[model samples]
Target: MFAKTLSASHQHGKRLSEPRIRQLGSLVTWLCLSFCSERLEICDFWNPFRNFVNLEHLELFADWGRPRKLVPFSAPEYGLTQLRTLKLRGYLPMEFVQWLLNEPAHVEELQLCVLDFPGIHCGGHGEPEQFFEAIPPHMRDQVVMDAIEDRRRLRGLARFADYQDKAIAPRSLACLSFDTIRRFKKLNKLYLYKPAAGRDHDDLEVYFSVSSEFRILLEWRDLILATRNTLEYIIFDQRPVCDLRESDDQAEIVCEVSHGDSYKRFVDIVLPTLIQGETFPALRMIRLFGFEPYEDDPCKEGPQEFELLGESENVPALLQAAFPEAKITNHIGRPIFIHKKWGELYGGGDVLNDTAGLLTIGEMIMY
Candidate 1:
């Protein structure tokens, strides 16, 4: 045997028996399962794969088209100690995320697409509500008293302290406890795929407040701060803020925050906080997709090619100054310059193929 890599995708109705999986455990060093469907019974069979102690890289992709219940797989007495990278896609259970963060694999590179935040309230929610039962009796009582006293605040070291012992579905994206995130002590490279635009955003808006998106950015800021000492490379994949257009004489940069006024508030009010405390010495690179050069006018686009815009011009500058030691690039990995004046010389899309190396949400899931 001794296979170096084993890859499978879109196995809609396939099943591998326990003995077969155990056989492959001794053979394969890397495994990828993609587009797993409801018929796969992943949660029920996940533990068997833990026997693959030599597995170094594991990639799992679930069918996002069909939302299914993902139960937490019980933690094994031993872990895949040699595993170094874990990539997951589609809906993942909160408890499962907790199990992973509990140092089961000690992965250094982690990629996630979407995390399912189950509703905490009991009753008909399509799935069984055993999340509350996962908490210990003592913690359950304390959680109730804290809720009664309105002491479940999202700040300081006490942030997410209640959720530390057990997992509870956060009501909103902003409320996702950091205790689960802070456990990624060995995380060095993180690639967080932003929920795609259109249907995804629309669904999120219906489920959560529009402001929750902006608030999640604040949450991400704190996440970065918490992991600043170890995290080296991070990428936030998102949609472009503006479309770059050019005519013969001049270029037009049209920018808009599609999520509306809250994102602007986040930019004005919260982003500066990223630079307030100690510098992130370990951060080597930060790539933010969707947000590029700052544009003054959103409505009309034209050759105001050389105009002087005031405080707004320093927007990109602030991000640059914040991470003095890191190289900040756009989606195409081209270095973004801090604009001193409004219509200063733009980088002019240095990469010939602007979309090169850019991975769409679909591409990310498939690959």
Candidate 2:
């Protein structure tokens, strides 16, 4: 049978039209809803989909209207007994995380892209023990929770600190980002995006200094020491900027970028003593994006190779020398050098320069 997609919207006081709920109620497979309305209670519209017995995928998008107590009975109920994926977007409460961890054992992937929450700040120093505690022990190992664009919300949790002190296993997780993996003691595979710009330089340094965010890099390093390790891949979608120095008494702002070769000076001067050897050992595959082209002669040459920031043949070579068995792939706009594991994938044509380019990376990824 073909999969079904359903969307619903309501104005202030009107109930969801009967036809809308009926269309979703009859679906036996996948269900997706992008709903926004000030008048309709989200629970009222969601109640019908809970009856589906054959749902394999379910997605919901909603906004914060009122605080609904997390109840055991009101969760989405797919009928097929084969639901494996759930994706939710909006200002999800901590209770939503609890519901996902409480979901049936068959669900394998749970993605939460929270655009806004009451108190969370992106890349902040807030403990998420209460949030993590909601995850049941058995379900913890089987679930992969992805939190995109999450900010830390660290205001009034002193009373909850005692519950957050316990440790949990990390192997159950597959892909996690932001602060989710920072507090996680054991993570198997991690995907890191570039940090957003416009953060205070001093605040950035202080946070990274204390948080476990850099520890993931260290853990990957340690995997190289032990032959038996869990980490298989470390994918950096964008380069991370570590040093942001503002000119004193001058209007100049200087930011230092860190990656493979370009970051050697920063690493030697600052990171060696701060970060240990095992920070990035277990990495077998490194995928880099958003690169600048390399110029052969600084005085006269145009551009030769498209070199990814912090990721060059030299850096990959260093990693290979240390690991000896890992495969390093550098993806640039076009092909450059030949390595045992290097291959180039062409990006969309120069239509990007045109006022109206037909292709974009976001569109491509969605397509």
Candidate 3:
């Protein structure tokens, strides 16, 4: 086949059918696959995809109706070494996720579909540690850190005049629920496609529950530690699911807390984790897209303004770590956290361009 790009969309119960089968050379470099089903029998032309050894992009979506699925139980790995960007949508199993995290993939940029993990935390259900341990061995020992002794400890130990690989341990991770960050050592950019495809951000709390939601966030917070050296940018991109009303609380925690409410809890945990100064030194920018956590419902007309999660003793360092330029802004493209003594922590009006682009919804182009 002389094809250069392949895009396939399969509705429920449909086999991933092709119009006419043809042999393609290494010239085919892009493959976009979307799917939906509950039946477990999702078959596609795996051999043809394999022959396209030059395939550099794979955008996959397996939209199973439920959080859990019983898809083709043992889908063998398709070896495609040249793949550079991997984007996943729809429901996924833990096994398939582990396969994506395989080290040899060497994906420079990744867009992860936010999905619920195996959250079985209750009496007789099993302990959280056991729940995590039950995952495959390759995805083990990834407890993220609160704070580390030093950056030297984060990198592997030394042997002789060079470095030592006693083991390439993910020792300094921020100990969040998600451990997949351990494999993306060389990743330059990571975009979290959020709770569900397009406009289902609220389903995160619904499907995963509030406590598990926080755990997911904790992992997201710790992700900085693993990629502090290589990771450059992060975007929390979410779209609205409804215009009726926002959640009663953006997130309400039943567990114990230093801060009383949900927003405060977030401020207490997430803010501190990223602002530690000693971590994510290589991070140039962290971007927040979509609505403010406490904003009023429905899309607005005359510009948007976000409330500032203002001052604490740590605010200065937070500014230093993330704002080092004028990247921080409110929804209306206004500066919320302005720096005076901390130097120019943001890019001034140029940050407004990003806000404009992101607000365009479906039109926002991905590079």
Candidate 4:
């Protein structure tokens, strides 16, 4: 009872004794594991974790040895029934995340970095029958399978993957998969990491196509619609859709979401269109990083080099109807302009410093 939190780092290339793990699982309320090497088997912790009945916060991060495949959690119910916050980094398998959400872990806040989703393969893009079947019947009508037609038109494009050419479906579903979240009745805060476009300044327009971007947008809409009764806050980290404009004198990045792969477009166009004037009464706040904050007084600020979209005054009717009472904050400039990865990871450099102080790797807090 005295040791309420435990943080362990495996750097010496030795397997942690199973007895010690089982012992600590019963004693610790917070558990953080940092595996420094790939030699330690990760599967060893699955059963031991069942003993962590008091654990409310679980953080697992590693620089290497992300699991290739995760066997189902053998128990009928998860030991982490009281889990409130779960953070997983290092490219966790989507199936594992699906399994956790499907079970009885009523996590309120989830932060995942570089989760494994299917790429443009046979199942998601070429033959999407399985993907469609996975969607719950109640929500199935909302999803529109337009990736097929889009891939058909751009068959000859050298950059795009020819999903039609693939012989069989990949092991994982390629489409935006959020059906499991329907089981999470109390989930309120979701934090996800998405790579920004236009990292290479030379090729500005080679990112996601309009159709692909729209599909992702629809997925977000469905997620909100499903959880509209309880979910309140949502934050998207490292999300950027911008272009690099270069001239003889200078070069700079400008953020745009009119028809591109940006969250701004999701708020401005997609949500408004899909909601059809419906309002998310429970939704209170939405935050997006890698974009400038909405400035109320345009005259107060001087001429800017980079163009930023999603001004509050531009489209009031759609914005007002869709969110109605929520506060939307778009902060930080385009991802390409940001210097530190943490700045993009959090909202800005200042917020990054603040977050680091509060949530370190091994620090513990008593609720």
Off by over 4 Å in 1: 1-20, 36-48, 65-72, 104-106, 117-180, 196-219, 239-255, 258-273, 292-315, 331-367
lDDT of 3 at 31: 79
| 1-367: candidate 3 lDDT, tens digit per residue | 1111331323234323353322343667787865444333333322234355566777665532222323233334554567677765434454554544543337666665434322222112223674344323432332221111112323422332322311111010112234456655666666653321111123221111223334444565556566667766665543222112233322211111111222333454456666655555456555554324223322222443332332223333454545575244223111111122111112222321223234321222232
Better of 3 and 4 by lDDT: 4
Give each model's whole-structure lDDT.
0.44, 0.33, 0.38, 0.44
Candidate 3: residue 149 Cα off by (Å): 38
Question: Residue 125 of candidate 4: its Cα lDDT?
Answer: 48
TM-score of each candidate structure, all chains considered together: 0.54, 0.37, 0.51, 0.57
Residue pairs of candidate 4 with colliding backbone atoms: none
For model 4, how big is the CA root-mean-square deviation?
Answer: 8.9
Instruction: For candidate 2, give the lDDT of residue 339.
Output: 11
Q: State the TM-score for model 1.
A: 0.54
Model 2 worst lDDT run, 10 consecutive residues: 336-345
Q: Candidate 3: what lDDT? A: 0.38
Residues forming the 10-long window of minimal summed lDDT in candidate 3 = 165-174
Model 4 lDDT tens row, 1-367: 1111221323224445556756866777787764332343333334345557667777765332324333344443644567778776543344444544454337777765432222332222453565455443543343354344335534534344643332111111113355555656776766544443433334323323333343444455556566666766765554443332334111223234321335444454345542475555566666555433445423226776545433533333444356757766554433322222111122222322222112232221110
lDDT of 2 by residue, 1-367 (tens): 0111222323224444567556555566787766433333333444345445567777666543333422223554323346566665543343333444343345533443333232333334443564334333543332222121122114433235432321111111112323332323333343332221111233222111112222323333222222223444544332222232333211111111223322332233223322345445454554443222223223114442333234433444454555566655433221111111111101111211111212232333243
Model 1 per-residue lDDT tens digits across residues 114-144: 4333322211122223433533344345434
